[model samples]
Target: MKYNTILFDLDGTLTDSRPGITKSAVYALESFGFTDLNPDELNFFIGPPLLDTFMQHYGFKEEKAHKAIAKFRERYNVTGVFENSAYEGIHEELRKLKEAGMTLAIATSKPHDIMLRVIERYELAPFFTAVEGSKVDDTGYRKSQILKEVFEDLHTTDLSKVLMVGDRFHDIEAANDCGIDSMGVLYGYGSREELESYHATYITENVSGLAKEILTCE
Candidate 1:
């Protein structure tokens, strides 16, 4: 294994969380009397911080964005959370990496509590050595900040041996911030152009391809 420690992004990278995320966003918007919102248009909410997504897409102020996030979690925590599914081949790839003696960890902007619930729901907790995510209050939502906690939890400072794998530019940017390598997945919500523009070290078209890249990384 070229990289001994692998950090993963939860939402777009590990799971197809689009349905739960977009539906929750729609529910939140509807609560504020914003009807007729299309879930397809809300795909941007998948990878980034929910508060930032609400503010950026809807021009909501900070306070209102927080309210919108609160509403989103109201539905997500109960119903939408379990609506997610692990990507095809994800479990097998994770098991392969774990058996290869690689250290796998989750570093996501999703709330830590919700992350745990989702992993448990999918029976993916056994493969990971550590799981790190944002606080429930939306504090520590940035990908880079979350990665810091993940690295700290893993007790490692050697960025050279760490690799971040995700489907969004934020994941690449965060890895760049930490001076570690990053691989972007094309099968998730992000476009190929988006991942390339962020200068990801490698871009794989699917989970199998991603696993190959990690196992063969120089």
Candidate 2:
């Protein structure tokens, strides 16, 4: 590929972190007297905005959702982040991409601070040129807003040359909003059917397969 930057999503794309997210989310729900989250339900909250999960599933008003977000961060910052791991082949693949002269960036919906901690802990931070994520205070948690921040930081002139790589429909949707190509990973939170429904330009079944797919993209 002739692209300069490859923007990746965190959570499902880089880490298989449903367990940590599930635990922390349930803790937040329990702290607020809501008990509707089963493990499976909690898994659904992994890739999207945390506040959206709180509001949709718990019926929490914005004020209460913000409080729950704070509590969620308290637990997540202390413990949940370490509960995740980089996917197999991810580190090597990222290093290879970086060495190949690609400018790597992270455009995730996770809070920027949390994303930084996870990236640094996993030693993934060294591979990327820049990491852009959602607000640290639980604001602008949408994928589109995060992508905009990343593009602005990179001073990218060609949106068509940018590729969004993620494991969910939100990533694909955000790429559509930004008028860029997107590739969905089947190994993440979203299923093939959902990714196809969003019309992902490409799809990779594994981390090792990503480089090949990207090279083949127009």
lDDT of each: 0.88, 0.85
Write down the worst ten-residue block by lDDT for model 1: 133-142
Highest TM-score among the candidates is held by which one? 1
lDDT of 1 at 109: 86
- lDDT, candidate 2, equals 0.85
TM-score of 2: 0.93
Q: Estimate, for each residue in 1-218, the C-alpha lDDT of model 1 and write its tens digit.
A: 57899999988889999999999999999999998899988889898888778788889998898988889989998999888999988998998788778999999888888899999989889999999888865533788988898888899978899999999889999999989999999888999999999999998887875666789887
Model 2 ranges with Cα > 4 A deviation = none
Model 2 pairs whose backbones collide: none
Candidate that scores best on lDDT = 1
Residues 1-218, model 2: lDDT tens digits: 65768999999999988878888888888897776668666777788887787788778898898888888877887888788999999987887777777888999988788888899988899888779877755443678988898899999999878999999989999999999899999988899998999999888899886776776676
